[model samples]
Target: MTPGMQIRLWLRQASKTQVGVTAVALAGVVVLLVASLTTGGHHRASTSVAAGAGAATNTGQGALAPATPEGGTGTAPVAGGTSGAAAVVSAPTTGGAAAVPGAGGTTAATAAGGTTGATGQTAGPLTASDRGVTPTTVKIGFLIANVGGLDQGGFALGLRTDIGQAIDAFVDDANKHGGMAGRKVVAVKRTEDPTNQGDLKAACDYMLRDQQVFGVVDSASNIYAATQRCYTIDNKTPLAHVYALSADFMTAGGGYDMTTTPNLDRIAKFVGAAAKQMGFVKGGEHVGIFTDACEPSNTVIRKVMAPAFKADGAATVDIAQTDCDPQAQTSQVPNAVLQMKTKNVDRMFMATSFVGVQNFLTNADAQQFHPKYFASDYDGMAADLFTKNFPPTQWDRTQGISSGYSGWLRAGHGLTPAQKRCSDILVAHGLPAMKDDAANGEVISQCDAFLNIMVPAAKAAGANLTRAGWAQASQRLGHVDVAGFQSCTYAPGKYSCGDSYASVEWRKEFQGYIQISGYRPANA
Candidate 1:
């Protein structure tokens, strides 16, 4: 039997044996659990670092208040304001040994005393002595936040999982088609404590130095800019980066280190746009935003809602902060929800993770308080998972926004050309589904805006993937064009691309199946 088959056989045989018969059985379970937990933690830390990086990358602070489902309207990411001009920024600059195209590119070895090119582009083709570069066998490390306790981090984690599933499908199909020019793409993961810098550093060190990964991808926060920039500069590992957070957050406080996915803000805007589309925007329309200051994602909700609340004019936006830990912060959210009800509030904008939102929705329902609930992508991802743990009441009240690429896949929206290519790869590989792919396609469109405008021009003189090459690759993306590919590009100075997020509203079939109902682009 093959090694994998033998391991499976051993596990199967061991399942029937008690510890009395084989102590190894008990050890195996323990080992698996520990490994899983460690991986999960690393992913979480990676998410935080990404969030912070975004925050550090921007220049202003605009807060958004949550909108209520009752009558208050919020704002969407329209193409006005300073976000359109788009700034050109350099990749994080670092000191390292200079690396030429072909010198030390053969193996996954970091050249000793090597200096990275100033281009800041995450990946470039350096002719290796080997046959050629293959997308398969190219393992990329994805670090995100998914620990159970933090709501924002947890939702982002769920989104990451969805993205991973898509990539897996894409690679499976690619291998069938003879792989990425003959190499199969494989993905690995790591998690870290999103709340701490030290943890973020530790996770990075392990993935980069120890694992010697080819590159790193993240659905990360802006807060992680410092570390991420450091890696980009030091490693010359071209990143297929996803700037999921909003441009507003990046500029907050002359640029703080707290960033998240742009989708988070876009989702919040959908809350407002949906309410307005339903005629909930008028004087005396009560809306409120609730965020867990203890969590970084909530900060994003507030930022997305600020200008939106001001723009709505008729809606009254109130802000409330909560603790990340629900058990310890019992009554904090329920009380806030009750306060909104007392004010005759009609809608709410939530900047919470799935677990936190699930709890708040349950508490609000038990109290017999009903209001139109709207949240960012953080809440939407766990919409299905929430049903498994919470009651049915939430299904009828909640609506949220998500990335177009992932949201389209999850809602079974029509596939684009790019998504189709990605899907074909999955089918060829014998993988189960492409329902959750979140990486690939025009996602790089968002990143392209930045890459196209960076200060020094990231493309090296002899670079294989030129600006034209990158742009052409991105243009081919369709909902079904490529299988589950949903990555954005990042060049030198500029970071965010203007691709707004897609929105989703929950519906109950009354027969126990709660699923996505109202879906659209939250623009206007």
Candidate 2:
């Protein structure tokens, strides 16, 4: 039988008990095939996505090398190595332009009017700017999670809502400030069930083909890399910001990521260094890694994290894997915790979804096995979630890494000017008295990208803007201070922007995670 037929037969043979397992296995096979095809046998050292922070690979050390200049082809040595850099050729400034080669030797300029210049040797400026742009308005699309949908699962719906509101507020503020290049900024919003591939593809198609948006800004989703492959890769539509963990988005080469989370390697190094500093790894504590099988990024992170912990003097390394399906995870958590307890894991690292973390914690608490927990921002260990679900005793033992400047707004931990501005904008947009939470941070992050990165790049692209022009303009943004929150940079070959993060620990008195260390670059 053919491989496809075999897969179908195997799927059919799977009992109800094995359905989730079979589905996860099939998904893995599909991802591996896609990765092989997309990478073209030229795999980068790491698989951390460009722009957004959280999914990481081994960076060797904490510090990243300087970015490649606009005209250079050398890749940036950021958190994820050479693959972190997406090659971006400089747009012609003087006479005309040339059709640059995109990923897989595809013509970078396929849209109408994106032809060669008068010289025929070089491509010309964009003329047919009708897609998502007009003399008075520029349309952008937003793809975010459907909070009230059936697939909400473990995602923090409040955070997604805050991000959506922040986008609205940013667009309103931009229009008030003369808009982007004399056109009012308008956002078209779409919600998707993140776990549903059909929903994600439909959303992408609607935004790119039907809405004809100039660009897309996607919030956190597990399947964002797949969406990029299905839509943006062939269409050449630039994605403004993505908060997913997959590194393929950067290496595939098309858009930019505004992520603050360093690559997995950097995260691993950070965890090791932080644990050592915090006395958890002094005499080599037993370390365990918990990961979700469904999220590909988590798999990459778990592989790197274990070795890094060992290199940093972990006494023993144990691993417990679980599925991302809520029901399956609920059943798996007790067994996973039991294994960890039996192994006497003193310090454990989690590379799973926020929901997965909650399940593990709930089970751990029941078993009275209180081990120190380490995680990255992607795990959704926000202060609010901890306060609501976990007791002070449970949360106080949790330490995680974050790319933001401050913890969720606390009384003594004042907000930076940019953060305050984000809060004010949210209030003005009718989200009054928004509490300090992960959602608030999500808002600030997206707003910072809109204000500091996307708007500036759009302005730089000048009149008669096209998707290609927007991307070229984005490439020119070498390094920029993001409203005092963090620093971001891009170049001809680099798309992973932020290169630093801070270590935070949960504090009961403050009711949130507090920054224990100052903002440190990936390189120690």
Candidate 3:
């Protein structure tokens, strides 16, 4: 079907099925659990999702890498299918992107030997199979969520399209500078119904089974899970997730490794910290926690808000859950606004979607049930939504909203060498304005991390990086520094990053995000 037609059909189908809608609503969450998994790992993550719903548990191998084979080798072969060989490493070669340094192997320019680090890790040693051979080109796939209504008024669409467009720019830029290593980076775009896990499974299965993509990069939460399940379990394909928020997707233990921040926890801390700050000044002692009484977000709300409320010094923290139906935004807003009037709530923290937040705020303004508004980053989308529905000035009452991420490449961070090169390529490819999204940049980070660790380990062991080679490489996927935004840990599989805690208050004067000061860890 045409992409347009597919999205409309998907949205209609989603409106009929409860699971489908939930997947779309909490697209950010489901992606976290299923982005990567061996068959066993898929089962484990699926079990986690079911457990969150208080359902019976089913077992799967939680994201464990396959085990090594019998002894006899220092390095594995790079061939396909259970050979335990090191995958031939190739660099993007169009421009000067430069190939990865050969592990303990002599290239025409560099020596083959180097000293081992104190960590007892030496450069990877190449096997006879890698001798005098050029590395094969690696294929990466991009599954974008650009379907229209399927995402409930383009929520997923804006995310995937905007991000995908940006990433495409990034890839073009990278290709101009030379692709990764010596191989040109190619992106294959596919769109699917993220809300339907079955559909996601089918789409991803085709990518891995037929298309033979080495890895995947995507922007939807629901699709993340389905793809991870397909790649890890069905075909042993690895992935690089762009905007998934569930901590599970980005961590090694869950069998999925995403490149974006696990937002709920970060947002919870931001709201809680902001609440405490407002309380000190406004004498606000109670915290009202509001969230969508939907599927995946409900679980995220519970995980992120419960702890945040506890930390806010709230004498009592009351929670309000809104309707799961997307259309209920109209009704849920008024209900929440009315309920807030009866309760002696000192402060309010909302965990919801852009439209829902806009409805709640618009209604609250009309009803004059204004309390301190502290919400997650998704609330930013509300501003645009409000502008489209109401006048720009109507948002005056809802000002002083603050949220932060590792950093915004579009906003400019003096561009890393890699980013600069990537940006240049995009501009050269007639996408000068498109480089602002940096969608693919995030994916590149994930893939870079995967390669940075895996390539070295594969060469060191001289094992071909089949599932076993990747499994061996999985041992060190923990505790990586992704430039400057945040630090990811596969060991604990938790996300700790920018604006760990931040708050924005609607001062009668100024309106905008205000970063919080005095940083401290959440557990601390």
Cα TM-score per model: 0.53, 0.69, 0.60
List clash counts for every candidate, in order.
128, 22, 49
> For each candidate, C-alpha RMSD in Å?
14.4, 12.3, 10.9
- CA lDDT of each candidate? 0.35, 0.50, 0.39
Best candidate, TM-score: 2
True-vs-predicted CA distance for residue 435, candidate 3, Å: 7.2
Indicate which candidate wins on lDDT: 2
lDDT of candidate model 2 versus the reference: 0.50
